[model samples]
Target: MHIIKYLRSLQIRPNFVKKISLIQARHLQTDVFETTKVKYKYPPVYDPYGPRPPPSEKVTQLADQIMALTAEERAQIGSALREVLKHPKLEKISTEGLDLSGPAAGDAAQAEEKKEEKTAFDVKLEKFDAAAKIKVIKEVRALTNLGLKEAKDLVEKAPAILKQGVTKEEAAVIIEKIKAAGGTAAME
Candidate 1:
């Protein structure tokens, strides 16, 4: 508003006051009488079919709420959860589908440290010659520790993960071995 007055004192030709008033009036009208806009039918939009439905407003709101939490808030929430779970009555609710006696509470830090030092891998067979199927199957068996029949079946299914959660070194060795046996393998 002060800028508008300054412009007026500078004798700017265009009337800023009128433009500002017009914009304000339009905004007010749209805000107050916008129910008609909402009531108007929208054209049908065809999206490619998928298994999962679109996220609801509540899910979006929940996601926003979670994302907006500070680290301190998250820590506080975690402590609150721990306190709640300590209750004997709440143990059943919290431990549902989880092995309550599996690990000690003292191992939580060790588990977190292990999570930070992630060690996992995947072996994907991209392509392989039909003639080398037998050799590829043998390598898959050795790498995956699968039965002969299962390994053969896995090798036949190209572009599939051969193994997962191995060390990266083991994954590389497996990929190299498969490639040497005339099969195209990828470490993922």
Candidate 2:
């Protein structure tokens, strides 16, 4: 009837239009119509919800403070932050070869070893008579400019040189220190 005419005006399909109109008519009631009435009103354009949590009060304050700083101040603050974040662990080093013990014991042992070596050399030199030894020492001192102790050392070594039949020139060369030191020898 009127529903078909309205459906035709709207250009709806005939079968669907007839079914929808019949359903609407069956469900329609005066009280139900009153209860389902919707008064149209504009929804709010701007939400009243508070700001997001990421840009919280503390973060906003910090950002504002950072933005307000001069270049030098900002650099100083950045350097300070880097220093705070850069904590390094200290390593414990083992000093096995460092030998923290005092040198007294080592010095004593070295001194004793030197004394033993000197005693051995003295025993070997005992084979030569005092006059031969003195004569050898004077010759060595005349040529080498060596002190008494060094001259004695040369004398102690003379037996070996004599065994090899070292020439006067060779002996003179060996005792060059005595000549430099202004010593004289009757033999030379």
Candidate 3:
């Protein structure tokens, strides 16, 4: 090959020339043999349980005592504990002119709004009188977009949820209709 003659003229040793020719051949071929190294940024893991000591016996004993209390008593204790756990420095710091409602407060307000908005309700038909079964079926059929056979089957399956994710007003209207039909219904 012309490459060998060129390498010989340059006085590159035979073995080095062979290596050079092989590398050239590799470059001439498809780029399948070439690879690129990539550096990646991996996020640090948060392991709260790692490198933590076990709770002391006294703490465990107190936990057991708290567990033994009634649910209402435990709730009261929990509220008291939360109050106790509040940073004491917060009480010492006087904010007479500073605005308390900052971005963090806005986030808290949004969370409260999310909790207050109960937009969805599930309407459940608890029971129906044998005499009012037909009326209940009709009411259910009207409330739901189900056919007569499906509505009848739904009515027969007492204590079943008629509809889910309905608005509060719609659920109330459905409940009222079912009640008027002599079927006990509730919204959950």
Clashes of each: 0, 9, 0
Each prediction's RMSD over C-alphas, in Å, is 24.3, 41.0, 20.6
Write the number of the candidate with greater lDDT, choosing between 2 and 3. Answer: 3
Local accuracy of candidate 2 as per-residue lDDT tens digits, 1-188: 68678879999888898798777776875665566659888566755774556768998999899989999998888668767898564468999867487668659877566553221111111134554556656655554577989767756654333112345555445445333333322222
Q: What does candidate 3's lDDT look like per residue over 97-185, in tens digits?
A: 66576558558877666565688999999999999999999989988989999999999989999999999999989888898999999
Give the CA lDDT, 0 to 100, for residue 167 in model 1: 94
Report the lDDT tens digits of candidate 1 across residue range 12-122. 767677686667678867566655535767558755663577899999998799889998887787668768788433343465655467668999887677655557978
How many residue-pair clashes does candidate 3 contain? 0
lDDT leader:
3
Question: Model 1 residue 165 lDDT?
Answer: 85
The order by descending TM-score is 3, 1, 2
Residue 102, model 2: lDDT of 65
Q: List the residue pairs that clash in candidate 1.
A: none
Worst ten in a row by lDDT for model 3: 86-95
Stretches of candidate 3 above 4 Å error? Answer: 1-114
Candidate of highest TM-score:
3
